[model samples]
Target: MRAGRLRHRITFQVPGEVQDQQTGEMVSGWETVWEKVPASVEALSARDLIAAQAGQSEASGRMVIRYRAGVLPMMRILHRGDAYNIQGPPLPDPDSGLEYLTILVAKGVNDG
Candidate 1:
């Protein structure tokens, strides 16, 4: 992966239970898995967006990051205060699997 292209900073999160400070009750929320991770975020093309939406899928963006284990579909990405739900499992590079991962993401979705 090219370091220059991965200029965008993003955070990876997974769904988990957290204690509500005031109420002392367990609430479902996002737990940070990695913070300030460098990545490349790109928007899907107009045709792709239309097709995804037509199929009841919200995948509208593609984000690429360095290869990391345990990145699941249930995880979400946080960029510039916007939450993006992971559309499917993270895909590794075909030629060199260890190099990077391509993740499909959707904005405005509550993954947690």
Candidate 2:
């Protein structure tokens, strides 16, 4: 990944259990594991496999982010206060000396 492309900052949030104030019961929520991580977010086209599947699933906004490790497939990407559900497992770049992570995500809902 080019360093210049990674100009935006995003957060990686994972599912966790927290006690609900109103219900006094454990509730599922997102907790940031990596915040303000530098990454490059690109709007995906149908050429990408994730975007192809997204089309069938009615996912309008499909994107791919390139960053270092600290996230997983089930986690959500919090960018500019908007949530995007990861579509599948992250693919690590195979190029030498640049161990970047490519994560596929779709906005508005979770596939689960």
Candidate 3:
């Protein structure tokens, strides 16, 4: 086996309220942002073995998660040929009263 890299591009939206300067009114909408992350896996490593085993199972599994603030429509970029096990939840800005996009990634065996 050879080392592999996985690339992922994850995206999500956050709820936000904006005030109109002229009308003095409030408006709500979904803001989107994206981020790119790279992960590498070595063949025959513990991580790789685990990922392969997980992939073999038909059960649902957990994923790795990450969050970013002040960034809308969150996204991720994973490297190619690598397996990933990731997950995340929204990173909310209390002051702004908005949630951040959560990204999740996971590794599994090829079912095909």
All candidates: TM-score:
0.85, 0.70, 0.24
TM-score, cand. 3 vs. native: 0.24
Best by TM-score: 1
Off by over 4 Å in 1: 47-57
| Residue-by-residue lDDT tens digits, candidate 2, 1-112 | 5678778888888888867789999877777788888788776665554546633453434333454555677788878877888766676767752467766677875322
- The TM-score between candidate 1 and the true structure equals 0.85
Which candidate leads in lDDT? 1
lDDT of 3 by residue, 5-87 (tens): 23333333344566767898887643333434222222344554467464433222222223244432232223354333333
Off by over 4 Å in 2: 19-26, 46-67, 110-112
Q: Which lDDT value does model 1 have at 5?
A: 99
Per-residue lDDT of 84 in model 2: 83
Cα error, residue 8 of model 3, in Å, equals 1.9
